[model samples]
Target: MNLPDTFHLIGGDALKTGTGGSLEHVNPATGESSTLELAGADEVDAAVAAAREAFGVWSGLAPMARRYLLQQLARRINESAADLSALSTYESGMPVVYAAQMAAVGPAEWFDYYAGWADKLNGEVIGAWDFNYTVPEPYGVVAAIVPFNGPVWEIGMKAAPALAAGNTVVIKPPELAPYSSILFGRLCLEAGIPPGVVNVVLSGPDGTGALVSHPDVDKISFTGSAGTARKILAAAAANLTPVVLELGGKSGVLICDDADVDSAVGAVAQFAIAQNAGQICTSPNRVLAQLGVYDEVVEKLAAVAGGFVVGDPLSESTQVGPVISVASADRIVGMVGEGVSAGTARVVTGGSRLDGPGAFVAPTVLADVATDSRLAGEEIFGPVATVSRVADDDEAVAVANGVDAGLAAYVFSRDISRCHTLAKRLRSGSVSINGLGNHMIYSPFGGKGASGYGREGGRAGIEEFLSVKSVSAQL
Candidate 1:
């Protein structure tokens, strides 16, 4: 059994076929059979072996060759954007346009942007006692471990930079969203990437662990939960291998007293819980609103959230689609329960699943939430937002900084001084003023502390996949 358009266990197809164990994909939206495949530890090993072998050649390829292939891959991704978008929406239970915005065109944009950097990857010349320079080098075989939510974009964020830097890869896509990433391999092949340079394996947590800890995997770039990130770090440490972890976020959103309450509520709600069903690591889960404007913000946000359409992802009008699975759906709702039990807030719109074959949850708004409330402190990857009232800007900054995870934070204020002041006070990696856009493909983005380490975008992203080597010689 195999998923549609998927060449599972790519590099070691023969060995993968021999593996007795099989994995299956259950489309949350349909509650029926979707895609299935055979994969196991042996198949994982074979994929790594293929990548390890490919690394020797790929890492040695001329920068021009690598640049050409990356550009080709970008073009191919653009050409096949529609199908990829449709598949992501179908499999992940997200709105088609949302999936397209993040997965298909987003990746194409990433690849094309990174393609330009591929040729420009430079070594720096520094003055020593004699002439000397530092050369940037690529790690051999990078194991890219992607999570279930927004899998394609995250994987592309990792693979494009690693490939552009001339590093071969063994990609382990989450079993929940395997098809699109597998389809991504086809795009790579169509773009003329070497056969073994990019290999894909589909499996569960165990399969992912084995792939990450494999001796041949020189570097691991993982995007998942904080708990999972710790384990991946441990696995990489066994071989003393390098790793980049982009993990969970319990980020904060601060709305100033003098700002536009309606705009802030709309932007914070949409950025916090609406996009990709609130699955992004950089999304804002805890909201800090100035006391003077808290009530108005909640009232406005609740009304706007009521207007969001939560239904079939295929529908053009759907605003919020199904959560990843029933289990995930339950977890999301459970957070709201804990919030209620803890006496932190009141549920405004929804706190339960929708009536459907799919695992859907309505847009949830929790008001009068305490700073330490379960909803405010925890990372709920669903359509839920927790609003915490702070006495002043100082208190707002305090509440924003009071989290173990600081991936991204949002701030709003008419005064640039106060905005910049609060932005500096927040401990997050990326701080947005006036509730603007997220970290683009051309800018550095990542988190600190439990949100995990390492940036994955722009020049910083490309640098994460590289190492510096000093060279000095007298002619």
Candidate 2:
């Protein structure tokens, strides 16, 4: 597959110079690599400047006009869905079908959803001494730093809402998988989005720092690990710039004794790891099973994991693909080793890395995991699941909430009332009952603790890029 070698900047320009350095873009599926230019501080400055320049014009446009442009951009994205999916698969090793459906179509749908909210961004008319009203105004230029996993979707999550709220954006796509983001930028221009309204800068942490610290950048939206969020928070603090962060998660799935063991195995446990090779931040890293059905759940989970089709991401039949990089793979393996050494967990099905060229690991299931073990507490961004037995519902909830990150959680139970009660008690940003889906384009998704703050979808998402102002007049 042919790919652009230069960084995508404002006005649809792809420039190789003015970048700090270059890095090889490695295909995790094949271990093949290609050199790609990395945007430097200068390019970041240029992108931020361009966004700042465009904010006045873009934000000044009528809400309906902005809505129309966003709809047009969504149409362009849908038109190029197939290409975007293939590019995502090539860069991130995501299964082709999943990439097409999730990354491509998902983002397109988000743009369309956010478009509908453009002209509907209303404030409030308060009762005061005079005619008092409020207005939600855009925060000028927004800097969006997206993670490697689900790059296109994250871009749309940040950009769609920002644009709908009448803000221009400078996006910093992750270095690991940036091809699709650049293509999206090109599509923006094709859809008649004004030059400098949407800029894509391909860079690593250095460029990200520069972009966040730039004076022109008014708001920062980021999705990545909590460690990175700390640094970004520090940098944004310098300018007192408002930030919205969606960080890492070690989410848990609680399997009740009365739950359907088969559904819990297939949907809750298996899908968590097999999907995106468990790179998802909200993947069910820990499973708390009631003691009454703990053995059955573990057996079924292990069997389902062992049955996953681990192979080429491009293959139609493949269910699981390689991790993003060798370093990530090694980290996953080390985590597993630590669990085994602690004697708190035992590998049930698959554990070691596959003997091949790609950075692949077998869909592994660890049973009898101690709640305090590293494997149970840490976010393992690989196809690995740890099952821990709990005595009762109280213990289940306790184990599920006993973590630094509380982004998403899952509960499997046949009783609706019980599910609702548990869902209310779970200390997670999102709680799914009898399922695995966490995020939707129209739902307000975010976390409470180390998982970070601020919602990223629906009306709440668009408001994140907006600032509230009150207007009063004498009647």
Candidate 3:
């Protein structure tokens, strides 16, 4: 694949000095070195400083000017969609087609979606005795920590709004997949964004603590595990910085007896295990099926899991790629093994690697998995799904809400009333009624409870990057 043009810390044409630490970008699909770049505390500081300086001008610009630039950026992203897709596939180790469709095209979708909202991001005229309105303003510098999985989507989601709302950004990319994130910065320059408006930095395996804890960072937007979110919150607290965390989920799917088994099974499998190898925070980890159709559902799902081709992500025919890494694969297998040891479920398709090299795992399915099993209770961020039988729709809802995570849920049923009923009782931020409906850019996307606070996407997304300022002008 053709590599990115060049990676640099560009702030008004200045390349900041670094501490000389470097990160080796590896193509997980081919197990080859892709890019090597600087990563250290010093580098992090420089990026933050760049954003700090740019915030003055960028944040001071009129909302119209900011919106104009964002619109232009969206157009540039559409122009570079092909190249971004290739780079995303090389770095993310996902199927080329899915990578293009999701990481590349999905980001473009976000830019275009958020761009339209730029002019519409309005502050409300509040109820007051006097003439008063709450004007929303951008924070100074936003510190966005993006996960490697779906990096482009989150980056665009975070950066677009942060920029549209007149905030400069210093993004701390997951070290494992910094290549595409860095290239995205170059695209920003090509899109006519002034230098220092957006800066990209790589953090070590320990995580981007330096960036999160930095004093200059006005706000923190993170997407990762709940365990990591805690640390980020604590770190940001020291600086008294505001934060927006979109954390993990052990999400569930409730399949009612009245549901179409084939359609339900297909929908759950596609979103749960197939998408990004189940790396998504909203991926359904547990499938709570009504006993009436449980057996048929399990059988159909097993067939679907068994048929998925797992190997190199770059292969056009490969439906599922390896887990993030060997360690990640091992963690997922171990979770399944725990279920097996507990005698709660049977590993129907895969529980281990299927290939000779790289971190490949068979598309694993666990049937008759007990509702209380670790595999069913925790967020297994891999292609391992637990299927459990529920006594009724009530029992299904209980099982689905048993976990602390309330991110996203899926309910499949033919009866409209049953669908609406289950959807209401299912404790999640968003629910897919019959199938996984396409998420509209105008809708709110986030979770409640342990899944993390705050919302992203649509009007809520842009507002997350903004702060309210009440103004009363004397006439």
Candidate 4:
């Protein structure tokens, strides 16, 4: 992958320097290192000022005219899919093919998906005696804080809808893997986006805090860990600026007593890791297998864990790759060790770090993990599986809904009625009856409690960047 001359794009220019010191990354596979300057308060102020200036011109354009520009961006993204996918793999150590599907193809699709909505934003008319209708208008400057795990897709997820709703954006990308998102900002310019209409800043916490707290930024959309979300929320509260957050989850994969053992095992095995080495926010971290099949489920899961091909992410044949950084890998392993030492979990298969050059952890399965234990309850963003037994359907439902998060859940059962009943009881935003890790872009995706509030994807995503005004004129 060819590195761009610089990583930050502000007001239609690629900047080579920033206020803070440089941020560096060593290639997970090769240990080769690279650095990009970390944008700071001054940079944040400039990006916000740029977006604030561009808002009037951008929002004033005819909806269809805005659509035309966005369509051009989508086309360009599709043409450069190969380069984008390669860049993601180089930065995040994700499987190249997975990167192509999840990150590369996603931005183009999101742009096209929302482009149609540009002209279709409708407001309802209500009247009994006099004429009255609602108008949905852009929220001015929108600050989008994107996570490192799925940097490319998260940009499209937050920026496309915000742009389609007539709002200008200042994207704050994490320093870990900001390359693709920075490129995205350049793509906007290449596709005819006016200067100051869209900006990207490669920054760490200090800059991010500034962006979220800036009074000129009317709205903020964030996708990241729950811990980070809290910090952003605290800053936004000062201005009372509304925010939309999509955070991590310890999602449950519940296998009913009637479920086909093989199929249930397959869903847990694949979705638990999802080929991104389980770094996904909605990856099923805990498995609630019915007691009738718990033993068999654990046995098969262990076998599947051992079968994963852990190697270089750039290779097409590699099924599992390194986690993003050495620190992340160490945290994951330390969590597992803590669980074992507490006597709440036992490793049934692979557990230790692999003898390799990159930050690789062995794909692991911990059988009979206590349902109430930290190992089963917390979000473990690694290539590890925690399996526990559920006495019956009631217990499974209770355990599934027990966590503070409710982003997603997966259930497998031969009985159709059981699937329907459990779907209603499950607190998750999206529940798969007999599937795993399947997300529909057109559906409303979000959570109820600790998973954070507000929604993204489909028309719901577009609305997050808008505010409604009720206009009533005497007829």
The residue-by-residue lDDT of candidate 2 on 164-236, one tens digit each, is 9999999898889988898888889999999999999888778888988888889999999888989999999
Per-prediction TM-score to the true structure, in the order listed:
0.96, 0.98, 0.95, 0.98
Worst 10 residues of 2 by lDDT: 10-19
Among all windows of 10 consecutive residues in model 3, the one with the lowest summed lDDT is 12-21
Q: Model 4: runs farther than 4 Å from truth?
A: none
Q: Per-residue lDDT for 171-250 in model 1, tens only?
A: 88787877788888877878888878888887666677787788888788988887887788887788998888877788
lDDT of 4 by residue, 133-156 (tens): 999999999999888788878888
lDDT of 3 by residue, 236-293 (tens): 8898998887887877888888888888888778877887888888876588888888
What's the ranking of the predictions by lDDT, best on top? 2, 4, 1, 3
TM-score, cand. 4 vs. native: 0.98
Computed on alpha carbons, the lDDT of every model, listed in order, comes to 0.80, 0.88, 0.79, 0.86
Worst 10 residues of 4 by lDDT: 435-444
Q: Which candidate is the best by lDDT?
A: 2
User: Mind sharing the TM-score for model 3?
Assistant: 0.95
C-alpha RMSD of each candidate structure in angstroms: 2.0, 1.1, 2.0, 1.2
